[model samples]
Target: MIRSGQRSWLGWLLSLGLVWFGSVTEATAQAVPQPHVKAELIAETTAIRPGTPVWVAIRLELEEHWHTYWRNPGDSGQPTSVKWTLPPGFTADDIQWPIPKRIEVSGLVGYGYETEALHLVRITPPADLPVGKPVTLAGKVKWLVCKEECIPGEAELKLVLPVTGDVPPPSTWTEAFSRARAQLPLATSEWKLGATVEGDAVVLLLSPPTPTEELTEASFFPFEELVIEGAEPQKLTRVKGGYVLRMTRSKVAENPPTRLAGVVVTPQGWRGAGTEPGLTVDVPVEPPTAFGDALTPTAGTTASKPSGGQPLGWMGLWLTLGGAFLGGLILNLMPCVLPVLSIKVLGFVEQSRAGRGQAWQHGLVFTAGVVLSFWALAGVLLALRAGGQQLGWGFQLQEPAFVAFLVAVLFVFGLVLFGVFEVGVGLTTVGGTAMNRAGLAGSFFTGVLATVVATPCTAPFMGSALGVALAQPTAIALLIFTALAIGMAAPYLVLAAAPQLLRFVPKPGPWMESFKQFMGFLLMGSVVWLLWVLGLEVGVDGLALMLGVIVLIGLGGWIWGRWGSYTYPALTRRIALATAGIIIVGSSVWGVSAIHQLPPVASAAATQPEAKSGSIRWEPFSPARVTELRRAGKPVFVDFTAAWCLSCKANERVALETAEVRAEIERRGIVMVKADWTNRDENITRALADFGRSGVPLYVFYPPNGNEPKVLPEVLTPGIVLEAFRETS
Candidate 1:
């Protein structure tokens, strides 16, 4: 958001040095300050031991809300660095950092400290006899702290301590060092970690030696840039025996790194009692598999010949058809589909007085609409996958533009439900297209809307069925999609075919109007959720513009209802109609322009709420760690999930998040790792293929004594989970 004119001089000044040696004005034996922060040099020991390393530090205490950066400043900004000016035979080690926090501003993420940050360094002295002699450790410290604007700061500091043969009492800052040490990440062989390339993602695999305390915060700060996309989402997914954090690959990074290093920080204690908050990560990265080779079936995979060109046995095809059908049947109940379907069905209720033939007509048209829409989406999926895009089910909603369009669509519908405007001969559809026909147009559009919104969820049978469908020939995939469509549309078809069901429906009267308005409020609630999702994808600016578009849509609806409704003169109605069109279309164009095609800027992942009391804390999945744990006689459970997957979220709430489940897992000493696939993840996609699934919620459990990993059911319950563990035992 910084304009070209703003902070041009700051960039020039940054060129001066990483350790910007500002002219000194010492307060107490050498400490300096300016605008927003105070910088100083401090020591850990009152007296230094000769022939050994002594601890010294550069401390910066900033004014409230202004802050500096970590070694890796993330998407934007420079790190606080120091230039040592020590006497001969003196050596300074690299700064030993305490864990830095995740800082977010204007949709950018950075790893840094707030309120205060103390960076420690070791100053080593050569072996020599110099008793009772004072030595000064001179250094220049430079940093950049930012709020609305960034300010460059520095100070030359000299810490004088007496050299002695005997150990000296701890300095005044002993307690401070102790506190910061608790936050520092230490190397641990207890964890077995590695990394792999999954198309545009770099997944860091982390495995703990044993079950860990609940990890309320799991943010990874890469030691170096170009190894991973720092600004994009680092999805933490659970897998059998370990955890995987899927990071978007940096666009500028063309080659895979031999070693990707960083720190994984947990504020509320990632590990169990009496453990450090920060854990070091230095792992080797795996190269990517060739594209267009997905689901080719590896040695360990169950499905050997699953591709679009090859035909499955008739039995397998039938099973796939059945599964697809059932998946669609369940899809109607998903969170995304209900709002649209609810209003559509209410329209059917209003048609109770209409003849059964008319009702039957509406039903058939609605079913046709659903079936055709499915076919279209299936075609797009097939063509794209054929063209070598690693997309899976529910891919349509992944686009921020599509989600924004849905928000606009739903907002206008809510307005209509509130009687803002009704689509008649005078005005157009909420999408801004004229609807010349009657009830049939409403029915068909309802079916289409249902299909569009249903793309963000994956039902039980849908994942595997979709896997098989996409791997089959184009015709076969279309047929499978048809089955799914019919399944979803079955209930409406049945109701329309049997007018007797209408008898159960309430009589349409004043109450129906109130109910319709109430459904409007519910649709508005859905709009709120969609808006939040959009904001995460496009940032606050994009979100604000989208809100403005929604406002325009509301205005258009009012204008149409006020002046273009049946009560207005023809010429007046025409002018209002044209004016509404301009407002809606213009605002929509303006809003969409705000969508940034570039990857997310320097913004950390939003702070997730701490796990509820008695909940299990899961770790990052590391295959090597899982193997080690198994060898040592331990069990691991992993859940492959995504942010957009409603079924995944539902499972977490219903089966996994309960206190009983946590207790049982704890009793069994099971380690849990989550492999999140909310975004496009090639590794997760391939992992799904290894299990013959194309989507989540996949569950795999690794029990002790080298038992084979047990793949649990897509849907879960406490008894079911307990029984799985028992069987493995």
Candidate 2:
């Protein structure tokens, strides 16, 4: 059945089929498609000459709507990386990243390239021999591609090129390389740029080489994390010398940076002839100046002075100082300070009965006490701020230990006012012999106590003045604080100076005792409020510790009042005093330590509140959440509040918690965010600074269109809140 010629032809056909099948299988194995992206190593030219530098790129083609990250992947994401396997004498430089587009996903901001990107690197070969030899360039590239979700991919890419003595022919990828080159950021001396920090924003001033149109669309991509809040919309406005871009500073950027390095991208038509559109900038960050100085000098024209120089202009400095004085005068009427001032008033009444000269001396001593306390507080605040702390006025009230101590002190004051013991014999006197040194010391201590208790109240004009004072140079800041001290003491000083004013006061009588007892009740009420604030800060455990301390304090006061002042034996009295002092000191120490050691409240537990009808449920505020809501085109309302701030509590009860406001907010579908600053929250502090405020009770309204947030007044009424929604709508 097998003829010789036929059998040979059949064998040859079978061998041909086997060869073709093997060739096809090898080709398929060499070209496997990677998930989410296609990656390859490409050269700009088909051939390279010896000693000449050649541009090689790792090109990534992503699926639709997918992207890969830049070197600095903003809020989140990892950048694409590559490792090359080069020939013996070849060297490769770092990969150059092109300008990245700002990509926002679920409120998180990222910098990356969509669809496709070319990461270029330059390679150089040694001048020695092998001109006719072909070289293989290989690299292992890894990248993260993300759409709604993220997928990681890796591929080994290889390219072959011939080495020659003549100039190489351009490859088909030449156009791709040219386009990538155009996207690269240019660094040149022609463009003048500068940056300065103002309040919580970093102001960037850009002066192009030639005149250009008002840049409506521009963005700055920082090289480091936590230098700027990437999600917060940047405000760009045209100034005299250049454009000023005001971007919110990151909460994590505690220390002011000396230099700011980033990429600045403008619209396509912004570039002048022969100038690059995008700039890679590394400019020095100028130190912050006073609000007054910022208004006078044009940014980017001249450099700001160093630290020691005065930053505030004359007009702003005087106006802020005047406001501080007026605010301090008004602080006397706040509920928190009223009880303490009552004791000072009683002392003034007693001194006035003695003589006008003695009353005036008491007033001067009290003024000295207030001024010294304010100066010390100002110094500490400045030092802490310089050391990179995001602190503001009333920061001390946020501390549970401090609040507890104030409560204990106020409680003891209440006991004194109740006449449980004689003023001079058992405790510091308020109405002792007016001309004695002891009486003067009591007057000074009263002034100090008043200053300490007044921290939680922010009177009208006080917030803006304190904010400006804190933002200025140290000397100017101290001057403003001094003015506040004088204003607080002025009322008492004038009353003492004009003895004729005392005619209006009733003569000393039995009714004064009832009034003193009533003031004691007021002080006790303040103590209760402080206890509530402590509970909010450290939870149930801290409340228990504070209550136990109060009980111990009461026991100690009883011991001192009963036996410590007088007894048959001097040794018995001394023992009783010692025991009382030990109990008071030990209980205070234990309470403070226990409160400080309490664990932080879980964020989820703190944010969740019981559901209620006709009430707006508030979500805890975070930078990411704000960004997300804004990106979703939803309007947002933010309440920056602290439990220690009486004004904050009043506003919440009177305005925010009202049914009318809630109904309106719900009808508008507004996203309500509560930034609780009851404790030390740096994020909330930074947020307050963004509105040029230094304390709590800040209300911010963000429109659906992502425009600048509208900051409401410190005092909010239901009508005021409803009007804001209507205007924005």
Candidate 3:
């Protein structure tokens, strides 16, 4: 284990602060707080002839287990990123990613590898090459690396190469460099890469198949970001010797570039990397008609704007409101909302019995709170956007502080549900039994609380609505916001307006206590989820502190609960309150200080490969290796999943455990590897991201070379699980 030594007292103080302030919110937050990546430029060719391409690469080596992300970092984690500064005449081509193995950890999936992976770039020598001089290439590299907690790392890397004739690179460093170059993805063998000028957009075509052409599983990774949404790639169908990949180009470009870069992975475990050759109408190249009918540019012209703008209209307003409203309503059901909702619900039930008039009044106040909170959120988002920030809705949760606050709120609410605390008389008036449980204030607050939780989930109607609303004028934006408030508050308002609805609810009795307790259990589960999220954000140490905080709270509660037994009730109450308050404050302070006491932020490194490290041996996923083992006749089970997706968790719980699946693996000496994709891991992300996916649920089985590896469906069944393993065996 690497131990952090205390050097500067100030640094140590900051480390403590990190520990204390780090919360569950920080745990699963996607972006790293401080990027820690370092980059250097290495070139084999000092100078090259004009019109000829030379090999130049920006080699980034992450510290230890911390890994930079790939262009497509599976479902989670930021991709390792770079922006190159080149001279006017010179331009750099896309960096090529080596084939990556899938890594699975906990229940989440990620795409990255331990140790090192290099990104190679092909540079086109300037046509007007200046002799005897070198040009400088500079780049700013920023990346997020995560082992458990993620930190952002960045560096400025520069390199200068001398100009020379078209002689082959020197043999001294040539072999090593050539080997690295060969490791890059190869273009399709059977498929000739080329672009066709369709009516409006240019369609790139892939021709020629590998030696083995029966493609049961295959996908492509576009060279450019934003060109592809990283959605699942369309299926590959065999046509004679080659297979055609049906994919849509990005909405940015009108005509295809001179070259398109991509990676193609087949069942053979073969990765092909090459540029899609351009189609010259003069060469009699056949235009592809099968790839989904050529996309028609919106304006009937091929020119695509860098920033795609939406068509103006009221539809945008409607979309925003509809999304917000639906999102708000759905928030009532999120785990994070349950504890707060329970408190509001119970208070309402009590208030209803007291009087209908008071209940209605309470409801309106709560509604105001909910609407105001949403508007506040909208204002913040708008402000950020106006300031040129790149963010989307739900960005607040990306902060560890926000997550910590939510976690605390939920924990306290959970305690309240368990009867550890209660709102005093002033606050109680709104929801007490004397007022009747559905007090207007309590109900309204519930609506507001629901909206807060609703921020996380984008409901069915929310996407298009929010998308449209976000693109609208400021006046229109507020109008949509109002519509959303109306939608979200409608259900609560209806219940408040119709006291008859109260009559429909069965009279509360002993079941009330049991229900409250059940909700408490649900709240506890939410805490567990939050803890996991926290683990992802700040590492395990922060989680330990959180656990400590919970324990401290529990102790304080215990003290408070028993304090009323003293003869002097007033004095006892005062002492108990003081003691509890002190404990809460002390714990919070200590926790915050402790967290911040660690080291200066460093990016998280990818865990070392199990096989090489000898920690826990997991064979890398390779077609040759799988074939060799199978011919020796062993079962091979490849888990192609990542760490950020939730569906991957459920499948692991329900499907991986069935007796049959375990028996096959153990009995047949099956090779199993769990690809983890939680943080920004380049290798694994490139692997999965290359396949046109951002999340997990991928499983593959390789029997022998004769029989191609079977691609399992996203959702797993007991039979599906058993059958795949059996085939491999």
Candidate 4:
């Protein structure tokens, strides 16, 4: 209805109105507000050079009282993440997070960035990129922001920069990028970090390259989940090199971590102003040795030995010495030593018929042998300890080779007792012999053998006395060992001194031969026990080797006994004996080498807490496991035992394996941990030292509330174990 010129004007106006409407809609969509955070993509430079790297940041600004999580979130919450979309020649590296603060919400703790944060990323452009072109770096950023409640938000952010051959000028975001870079964790090499699991805490040792200022506050943000209790306070102790931070282990940390990777925050005074915020470290966790300050002996004390309890006064020292003597006297009655002592007793009976002087002289020489052996053992123990070796009583038996040697010795002694060969023929008195001189030498050798066999038994009262001796000065320790030796020889010495006591002894006759044969069986029993111990140490293949060696030894013994005693051509006899010796020596060496080559026996079955076939189950002991369980608020019962320890075996068979004890343990949910000292386990040795005792049969009970563990007696009864549970529960 309008004119042509008017119609053209109307069409132009209509088109203009439509374009304005479209612009408004696009602006509204782009300006939409996130739930609790605002995010933007920023660049440090307006342009990027070809073949050069440039920094880009995802800036997250949270609302008042709101926060974004750090990489480790801590206990709960999700950290900020970004997915990049870059040009073909451009590559984006991982996000670099700034130092975060610890935030507590209710009872939970979290690590996060409050107020604002810039996560920096490095973008590298290919050298072949055309300098005239522009490139767009885009990111889809997502974050969890929290106040009283958490809200998730996402943003699509992009930055366009022109590629140039020259260095770009700084943009408006330069200051922000600099600030973010300042807050980032320093390189790991700047500081030395070490971690150890001690009791219920993870001790972190931090040593800075330069002397650091006195630290007033510090915190750790673990990169791994469930390693430490985020809510628990960390204990910091100033040490020689730097500081040791003791953080409580989380209940969920079942195994000790191989490395502690995380960020640590300290005050401005700690490492100077520039490095005030944080340090990123990945430290290898090492087993604690006696070298650290924590293990160093107290002022005025020698070596690293801890005071087992209160210092022993003169009266207490004498009492401990008396206890040592009584323990040694009881050692004579222990099954491990009794068989050999019975042989010595027979020797005494034979000497008694001769005269008092002869018997007394033999007893003195035997006593001298025992005393000298004890001195040697004490010296070795002290020397090794001084040299930083964790050794205890009966430690020699832990070696497979030593155990094999003992087995061979016992087998040969058994053959002698069975009268396969006379005592002086090819054994103890091979070279020369006045009959009396041969007898004296035999007595001395018997004492030495008895001392060697007695090592595996921990008689009553021996634990406490030996513990005190090892913890004391070298001189005092030797004195205690000497007292033990004297007590062992006391009964025999007394009988020899007073010949009147011989009247009660049965006279030697045909019964003597039968008795000697019976003693041989007992010696064979000991050999069987040693073989069983070896089996536990080295697994099935090692057991086969030992059995084969036993067969070879028996064949050599028979050949030597049959031929060596009778008259024969000298050359033929020498050749025959040499052949026998070669067989025995070769077999023994091969067996020992094979045993060493075998892998360590797995104790998986022994490490569970459930009963199997009506027997109590136990988990193999580990120091870290004990600490982890204790921190989890569980009760723990540790049995420190060795296969060679007769007391340990007896207790296992009598009390621990009983149905009543097993049921009680299950009911109480006790964590039964067995520390097998059958091999050279430094962990077990350290644990023994912690208890002020140096030997096995140590029973330590940790209550549910994490109190100091209660030590049960070396010998346990079902009632005693149950009663202990009741008290702890």
Q: Write the per-residue lDDT of candidate 2 for residues 364-400, one digit (tens) a residue.
A: 9888989998888788888987666878778888777
Better of 2 and 3 by TM-score: 2
Q: Of the candidates numbered 3 and 4, which has the greater TM-score value?
A: 4
Tens digit of lDDT per residue, candidate 1, span 1-729? 777766786555543321121111112345577678887888776666778888877888889999899999987888999999987788999998888876667767777889888998988887883765667788888889998689888888887666666665466677888887888897874666777776777766666667542221256788897777655645544454355566777888777667778987654354554678678988776653422222121211233223112355577799989999899888877665765755665655654645677668878888998999888888887898665566677677666777777887788778877888776521112222222356577778778888877755767787778877776778888988898999989988888888777787676567866777787888898788788767766678777878888988889888988898768889999999899878877777666655635243211112332344677676644344544566567787878776556667778888988878888898898887766565455555656655666667788877775656788877788787888888997
TM-score for candidate 4, please give it.
0.57
Best by TM-score: 2
Put down candidate 4 lDDT per residue, 20-51, tens digits, no spaces. Answer: 43233223323225887778877787677899
What lDDT does the true structure give each of the candidates? Answer: 0.70, 0.74, 0.52, 0.74
Clashes of each: 20, 0, 99, 3
Candidates, ranked, lDDT: 2, 4, 1, 3
- For 135-154, candidate 3 gives per-residue lDDT tens digits of 66667767667777777767
- RMSD from true fold, candidate 2: 20.4
Model 3 CA deviation exceeding 4 Å by range? 1-198, 202-311, 323-341, 351-354, 425-431, 436-448, 474-485, 508-514, 564-569, 589-729
Off by over 4 Å in 4: 1-313, 338-342, 423-435, 567-576, 593-599, 603-611
Which 10 consecutive residues of model 3 have the lowest summed lDDT?
297-306
